[model samples]
Target: MEVNPNEITNYATKFINILIDYSPKLISAILILFFGLYAIRLVNRVIRKIMLKRNLDPTLTKFLADFLLWALRVLLFVTFISKLGIETSSFVAILGAMGLAVGLSLQGSLSNFAGGMLIILFKPFKLGDTIEAQGVTGTVSEIQIFVTKILTANNQTVFVPNGALSNGNIMNYSMQGQRRADFSFAVSYDTDLKKAKEILLKILNDNPKVLKNPAPAVFVQSLTDSAVIFAVRPWANNTDFGEVSSETLENCKIAFDKEGIRIQPYLQELSKKNS
Candidate 1:
């Protein structure tokens, strides 16, 4: 190669001039980037405190905090790059394209994720709540980001996807603190409906688990082909609901036996057959 001292010197001088012009700017950008990151973290902590004090749903609070932090960091990075005189439009376009691709590839997963977010934010039910949803009735043992786990009374564990759970009808039995025990009792049509009502009332009144203020109700439900049906409804604390219901039925059978009251159809048919 032929030696070109003038050209080499000119290239070196241009390079030095460019570095001199950009050096201070690069330092400033670097300082701002570090400080901005620290500031973002401080702001995030303050946001967490505010959210906690406001009693914001914990899931929502965590997600919002994380999203905001990432967004702020992205903005800070863009600003730092722009300070170095680089265009940011291309970066934003690339980000949008990536997001679109990811969304397309994970449609079902995204749906479940969004559903979970809705449930957590809205709080239709919580752990320990006995809820009926998606064709099962159980106590909510756990609520995860994408699924819910329930323990059924029959000692079965069910895993329901959040997408279905959030969209499905949820019947929360434990939220009300009290539950109604509805019992149907039948006597032969020959038996007095009034006496049956009295016996049912006495059974309900004697049970300590049954509520008082709302009061128990005993009413003639229907006159079926085989018997006269009576409906007994009693209110009890949710914790005592099962016990109250079972004990009431057992006691009623005993009392009816002593009082010569028999349930409809069976005894009547037996007596006719004996004759």
Candidate 2:
């Protein structure tokens, strides 16, 4: 068989011409890739510094920075592909379709993650703070990207999804530094209202846990057929609220007993006996 040198030379020439024609674009793409990476890093750093200046939560700042970094890198890759004379619209469309599929599959998780981001950014409550949300009242034990851990009064740990928690109402008892302990004490209608109010007020004043600045209040809230309801409101530090209320209720019972003030239930029993 006769070897054709002309055909071999023609193939080499075509290969060289193709490489020469694409070299500039390949080099430009490489340069853009490096520059785009640097720019992404710079943007991430700037964003982190801004978040720090605003005193945003450290966890949230890191999460956002990382997310932005990846997003920018994806955009940079697409640009690099386009610069190299590659069609990118179809690639971008494919990526979008994949993203949408993943998003749909993890809709609840994405919602929770978004909620957690909002919680961390807005800081409605912090760790160790007592909060009432999603029908659970407890101290926040931990906060994560999708859930919050709460330590209930019974020592049970409740994991609440951040989606429902952030979207729902939150009562941050620890935010104000103090909370009002409300108590409803019913007394017999025959009992002296003035004396009962004095006793309740005295109880609040004597308790060291109670805050004096707000000044505890006692008023006749409502009158029933058998009793007068006294609404006692005492302000105390969040930490001492439970103790303050419990001790005050115990003290009230003792004081009322000593003062010969018959409570509503006792009068009810007496009425039943007489009838």
Candidate 3:
């Protein structure tokens, strides 16, 4: 059969005309997508500026801005796609499924992040504060989004996840203006309690670091088979805790020796040696 050239030309012309007619719509869609992305970027910049002015934490600000910016961009893209005559129901469903999967996979991490935010907002403990949390006692070095960094008294760095910290009890020693230095001294049952109490009180008077307002407390806390346990509790500034504790122990020993107070020895050790 002979080909109809004129008919083929007519069909080609119609197709070209159809494409020309749809060109404006195509251009409009492209413009919408570009403007949507630009608007997202602009919004992110505005958020960042506001956060900076408010003196918000840099990490949190960045996280919020990025999260919001991406969310806005995705919304805009979806709108653009729908405007371009694509069905968005399947897209939305796919996004939902992906989000659920991600949430499940990162549940622990997300909880930690939330816990960190709570910790930062509440100001429970700040950097450089000595705290005991999650069974670790150390100076807080940094509070990150997922983990809190601590400098241990032994000079080791510890990274504790925020979720565990937030869930557990926190003992902030630095928060207290003054801390009590508690010591238990054992004396022979025959030793005079009045003389020992007087010696302890005199030692407290000599130590200028000990706070005089609360006054030092001395009492016989317990009577064991081998000795009488005397409790000595004194208040000192948090900064002077270590120094005051060591000094109190050393001075107590010296004071007891000078006052002729005898320390009770371990009776079990004597029995073992004899056996």
Top TM-score model: 1
The deviation in Å at residue 245 for candidate 3 is 1.3
Q: What lDDT does candidate 3 reach at residue 220?
A: 86
Position 29, candidate 2: lDDT: 97
lDDT of each: 0.83, 0.87, 0.84
Q: Write the per-residue lDDT of candidate 1 for residues 6-104, one digit (tens) a residue.
A: 999999999999999999999999998999999999999999999999988766777789889999999999999998888899988998999999999
Q: On a 0 to 100 scale, what is the lDDT of residue 193 in model 3?
A: 95
Off by over 4 Å in 3: 1-88, 265-275
Q: Which candidate is the best by lDDT?
A: 2
TM-score of each: 0.75, 0.74, 0.72
Model 2 residue 32 lDDT score:
100
Q: Tell me how far the alpha carbon of residue 32 in candidate 3 is from the true structure, in angstroms, after superposition.
A: 6.8
- Model 1 TM-score (2 dp): 0.75
